[model samples]
Target: MTFRPISIFLSPNTEKDDVQLASKLLFKPWLWKKGKEILKFEEKFKKYLGARYAFSFNSGRSSLIAILEAMDIKKGDEVLLQGFTCNAAVNPILAKEAKPIFVDVDETINMNPEDLKTKITKNSKIVMIQHTFGWPAKIEEIKKITQESGLYLIEDCAHSLGAKYLPSQISKKLRRAKKLCGTFSDAAFFSFGRDKIISCVYGGMAVTNNKKIGENLKEFQKKMNYPSNFWIIQQLLHPVLMNYLILPFYNFLKLGRIFLALFLNLRLLSKSVVRIENRGELPSYFPQKLPNALTLLALNQFKKIERFNQHRQDIAKLYKENLEKRFILPFAREDKNREPIFMRYPLLVDDSDKILTKFKRRGIYLDDAWRKSPIVPPATDLKKIGYIQGSCCEAEKIAKHILNLPTHINISPNQAQKIIKLLLNAQ
Candidate 1:
């Protein structure tokens, strides 16, 4: 029997078409940033998300930074956010010269409204709500608190592009309308990165119903330079690497782990990777515009979102039937309209180290990489990142115990069985 390693990413059948689309466009160098592609993609995306306006960025960090800037969040202002989230969500708060006040998360691995109410200070000007792993936070409750307190709400929809957080018990009349994650907040952002549900190597978008935020975002973008040709080429080369080398080749991942260890030990990737940026604090200035290459890649992937998301939903159902009760899992509330996208199926266990070791031995990928620290990638100071010690007890516990399985379209039935087998055997 072959040592089958279940990888989370499925090599897209559209990889050839993606490469072809990129090839035809590469000859038109002037079209790099000047083309209708970016604007067209933005228009389609805004309609898809039910947002009134959209602005593309080079990365999620850039989008969030722009949001803070647009909101005029300045020195001494506090931006309250969940402690148990990626550093990309927190770095922008630090970058804007404003202080980040860490809030705790509930079982959803998202912002806890109760904890949020307690953490708000007189200086608190914004609330950053993240739908971690596409598990919707108690949005209606959080929104009410932010509204009553006069705080701006910014949703981090990086992991939850298609997720719906239906109306909570606000009113029977309002409960019928289902709200997407990005639409519910004052402003929101999405990431199309290597591992995100909408993979395009690297790209992000800032969206808003607020005319002011939309206007400010366009103004800020006007001054930004387009990504260089070399950078574009690298993005163009992703399909081959992802589809051919990374997803199907178990040996590549095994060797990649060794390479990663060497890279970390030799300080290759950049020390502040844990913080989602190279420096613990963001630079005074960074590239903020979306590259044409990423946009082109994103456009190709955008067409297939429905099919892939449906597959992800199917995989989540299978996992629930097999792995429920044996592990702590995420689900929608009483509202039938609310459904998690299941970007990654999260489970809290006794010892992640032991489980990670067991899965590794079998070439089965359980996500140990998502939460090395509360800010992820291990060996980072929560204090430096603006999180106070002993403030988020639940987040801290969830961080240590949480692990996830990939629910991408590429995972087959046999691979899921192996994952279930491994998870059930846990002591």
Candidate 2:
């Protein structure tokens, strides 16, 4: 008997429009006027985020490097980051020739604000906070610490787009309060990658209210080009060919390892590793050029972001209602009045390895997302600053015990129920 496979996460592109547009663009090469599209996408995205400026890039990592470059973050400067996050978040700090100071995460799975204060030092120049799994960090407390210490705050909103965080008491008293997460930071970056809440197949954006950073990013964009036409064509065809055709073969044949190895070996999928300048070495900054095709794809998908976010929110709610008892759920901050567009539904469980094995036997897939700290040698002194030693203890425990069920637009209620039942049984 063939069992249905349940994946942990899926891109939000159920509509056939993305593929149709890709096909149209492929046929008419002249229609690939990326500059105009990129600018329009950037403007719309900026407006969506309520940010003053936005710039598109080939990937989230590149966008992050661009943000660090704009800020002039140099070698030896310590940037505080959460221990439990993707390499994309940490690699950029390394690219800037800076050292990442890994901080503990609170109950929300975001950076611990108190820990952030202790990490601040004379050498610390920036604090990079990720809104982990769509939960916003304690931005108000973090902002206060940064302000008092004269440090820069950079928000990594890779997991959050439609998410909102309410103003703090201080911010409310000021009458003109800043939004949490992205808005609280001096600059922020977002991803529209395949596994993200939004999907452009591959693309990212950098945003800021700071005029200088925006101008720098714009100047860099002027010199860059999109990925080649060949890449764009492949992306256009992937949804139909890879998702439906190739993926099924791999699943049926039980050739996942072989498939992954082959996929990684392909030149198109090879990782791009670029060395970034430390704080002071560059004469003039120019944003590195990314493939033009990615920019075009991101531009096309920017319009459907709201629908995508809504779907994710709905699915998250379902997971919460179904799985809350057996696992510890990460919820939107109660004090902050923001709705999160959950990128991943992370659950803390007991005996993760055993539960994962059980789920796998039942044809369910769960991601071991961000298990390793990308920052070389994770920080050891976070507790000195009153950071709860076990702040991210839940995440760390869940990282081993938790299972991420399919929470995408394509997942049916039946599929979700099946997953919930499995978890309940496991418990």
Candidate 3:
């Protein structure tokens, strides 16, 4: 049997008009990394999320750092965060010299609100909630708990760009409000990384409803040096190149990851460019400002995010209908009036090595592991960060078994079925 590879990123077909629009940035090199595009991106993003304030950054890790800087989460402070998320989210806590307290996630792979309540202490100053894989974590309950405990909330909306939070209690003001995923918390951040819902290749946004947090982010931005023009050009043009050339040959791309590891080791590639589950020490470039051209690159995709995300939902619905009972699927929390972006459909298997090998031979690709760390980056010893073992047992177990399959809009219904068939029969 001949195998057809499926892709989650690099799935979208290239549009000539989109390419022409992007070319406008290259034409005017003067505006390549300017404040004008950055301002425009923020304004439009703020309006779209209905957020009062929005600021762009070079990466989500930078946005997280600015949020912590704003909250004054310093050494001796405890930041309660779920262990089952990207290490980028927690690195900022350490950058602030604060200790991170691990919280367990529920079946949804989101921070369990019950576990959140248990982790808070007098030293706990902030709580970072990740809307894992576009699933809105128990937002209302967690928000209420954080508010009562006097902990500031930072919604890591990187995986959930358009995912929303529907309030259970609809008061007069709440009735008119749209509780988008990033807007529900004190301050939130979104990523435009290579694999995010809308990839601008490299960028992030810091958003908030509070004026003080906005000012703090601005102060942080003032200190950041702009990214290199070569890097900006590379990031700007990579998306279309990916969609047109690389993604179709994803298995080859998977093989190329070994070369990437070599490049990272040789220092030919920036460590920040490719994230690893166990990259021991973070690069010093965590907190940086966005380039004007990259913001323009992000804006082009942002305009089409809603449409792109809809296709993702259609694919997810198909997977939900077809893959049931065959696999231990991700959380399907009810009463979620908002739609999840469904970045990828998560699967929990007993033996990941068996599943990964079965698909790799068949030319199907899956995420290495949805972070194989109870405290993401399994190599990081909790004792080093002042966290204890046995704090989040479920996270450690799930990390070992969990992997995500592609749900890119490019996946045809027939292709999706092929994937379902493979996943169902793999074990």
Candidate 4:
């Protein structure tokens, strides 16, 4: 018997305007004006994030590498990060020939500041914090610790773009709430991949308050050549294929990942381009140029971010109202500063494998997003630092037990309810 598949996460690219704008890039090739469009998008993203400088890159991973490179972190230096995160977040540190010191996560699935504080050593140079699955990390405590230790704090806001952190009491009474997550850190990165809330086909951005960092990032971006024209054409066609033929087929046949992996391996796939990393050394500069088409597409989508965020928020509410009683749902911060536009609705469960298996039997798709540990040295005392050691126990628990119900803008409330019911009854 066929069963309805409820995916954990889905792209929120349902708007007609988004579709039309994306099509324009495919049908019409106007490279000359793309730069201006990119700049416009950067400005809007910066404004939205309350960051001073926004630099777009080819992908979120590339942006992470660019930010680390721009910061001048080098070999033997240690960058503290959550143990549970995508390889993209961890690989860049290794690419720099720097050590990635893993830290444990708190209930929020972000870096535990307590764990972070313990990991700080003389060799520690940067603290890379991830806002995993759209839940905001405790930036206030992290900011304080990083400041006192003189360590550069880099917020990995890849999962939580529209998410906001309220000002601390001191900041609120004093009217001096520090910048948002991306702005709070020395640098932060965001992704605009196909599955992200903001789908620019494939793109990423790094934001910072330092003008010098922005300049350095731009210089590095300029050195990297733009993506090939053929690749740009492929990106332009991704949304059309994904929304119409591909997604429908996957949904109907319950072959989302099988088809996705096959599609990704195709030579024509726009995101297939790989940048060679110089082993055991940090490159002094980036050797790539952000694709003009990516920049233009990202810029155009920036205008509609508010609407996109709202949709995510609505979905989050539905998840909370429906799923929280049965699962460990995330709670909003007491501080009223900034509410999160959830990137993914994560939950903690007692038995992940069992839950996942049950869901799979029903053709419900709950992704175990970013289940690996950062490829850091084995003796980094990651567990001691509370960076849940042994391959992201927190992330694994969430991946196995937690279900990412379909919460995209395109999914109807009834669809979401159906997913919640399946999960609720599964237990």
Best by lDDT: 1
Over 4 Å off in model 1, which ranges?
1-5, 9-16, 19-31, 168-175, 246-248, 252-279, 283-285, 332-337
**lDDT of candidate 2 over 171-257, digit per residue (tens):** 447545445457778899888767676666656788999999989877766766656665555555544443544345544656543
Stretches of candidate 2 off by over 4 Å are 1-4, 9-14, 28-33, 169-181, 228-234, 248-250, 255-264, 267-292, 332-336, 372-398
What is the C-alpha local distance difference test score of candidate 2? 0.65
Clashing pairs in 1: 10-410
RMSD of 3: 3.4
lDDT of each: 0.75, 0.65, 0.74, 0.67
Which stretch of 10 consecutive residues in model 4 shows the poorest summed lDDT?
A: 371-380
> Candidate 3 on 9-53: residue-level lDDT in tens?
442323455555555665677877766878899999999998888
Order the candidate numbers by TM-score, best to worst: 1, 3, 4, 2
List ranges where model 4 is wrong by over 4 Å.
1-6, 9-14, 32-34, 169-179, 251-262, 270-287, 332-338, 357-363, 371-400
Top candidate on TM-score is 1
Q: How far out, in Å, is residue 209 in model 4?
A: 1.4
Model 2's C-alpha root-mean-square deviation from the true structure amounts to: 5.5
* Candidate 1 residue-wise lDDT, 1-427, digit = tens: 4333565533322356775666666566666665667898899999999888899887777888878888888898999988877766777777777888888888778888998989898999999988988877788889899999999999988888888867755488886767788988899989886678776666789999999988998887787777666556555555544443444444554654554455445533222233435245664324468876668778888998887788788888878888876877755234475777888877777898898888877776665367656776555557677777778888888888887888876677677777888889976
